[model samples]
Target: MPQEFSRTERVADYLQQELAKLLLHSVRDPRAEFVNITAVDVSRDLRYAKVYYTKLGVESAEAATDVTRVLDKAAGFLRTEVAKGSSLRTVPKLTFKFDESVGRGRHMEDLLGRARASDALRGNEAEADDS
Candidate 1:
């Protein structure tokens, strides 16, 4: 019978939890202070993992770049910490990536708000004309 969760999936989930704790308490860089781990994707061989992260109150490209730089520089240390905390024989290399989904969602919300406001205005104007 096949396992309910593959080794890679298990590793990815473990890494995500450990990394979140590490980022929250271990990392001290100001750029990474607000970093939130959005998702973790581990390779089937468990040799590499891509960590998606986002920063609070960092919307500009320059700010995002700075956060990414800090996280990437600290990847080695993070990986070492993960190795010490987990029972895995090999800890996957960490790659830091800025996740833009949050920002995209905010933008979508703004667009939706504008659309709704416009529709309401049109409805109001139509009612005024009908009266």
Candidate 2:
């Protein structure tokens, strides 16, 4: 027999994989184009699953409520499909959250690049002035 993963871990894994797949092709909503699930967290009792996601190419990156509505609409379908392979007693409810870490990281990198350029320009000016 295969080793059984903990309930929470299994749920998390299922949500991550299944939701990712569902978002790729099954979902018909235009709003989903900018959304991508980054991570999933399932409750110990399998009552809830928190999905961390990010918005790509969208201004303001929207909010959790946006994903929540999509998740709410998709939950029944996700649960039904997830239950097909999972032996767990219950499939947790899906809750989507906007994960901004990706955007934040890109912003930080841009800031660093600008700082480096400024420093280089300053160094060049100082050397010119000393000549």
Candidate 3:
């Protein structure tokens, strides 16, 4: 007997393929602005998937809701698209989710820059004290 494929892996692959198509062809979301699918996580049973996406252009909290609503509405279409794209027997449901990792990483970089500036200032002060 062939080993069964895990639900999580199946769901991840489905989401990546379907969302890419929707972004390229089907979706007509007004709030769309260079959205990138960063990652995806699927539950054990393949019922729901948490999609991680980031916006490259201007992004706002209100825009996020519109994007999500469009994605939710297009889930069925996405499922069909995924089925067509993959060789799997089943495709898990798609769920659009905002991934904050991109934002968090940006925030951390800002903090690091500040810390570096502060360290440089202190080093200058130490040099002045020695003089």
Best by lDDT: 1
lDDT by residue (tens digit), candidate 2, 1-131: 86688757866877798788878877778777667788999887778888888766632345556756776687788777777766767778776777778778888999999999999999999999999
The top-ranked prediction according to TM-score is 1
TM-score of model 2 relative to the true fold? 0.80
Query: What TM-score do all the candidates reach, one by one?
Result: 0.93, 0.80, 0.80
Model 2 Cα shift for residue 124 (angstroms): 1.0
* lDDT-better candidate, 2 vs 3: 2
Location of the lowest summed lDDT over 10 successive residues in candidate 3: 54-63
Q: What lDDT score goes with residue 47 in model 1?
A: 91
Report the C-alpha lDDT of model 3 over 10-117, residue by residue, as the tens digit: 668657766876786776766664777878888787667777676765244454777777667777887787778777667767788777666777888999999999
Please give the CA lDDT of all the candidate structures.
Answer: 0.88, 0.77, 0.74
Q: Which runs of model 2 end up more than 4 angstroms from their true locations?
A: 1-7, 59-67
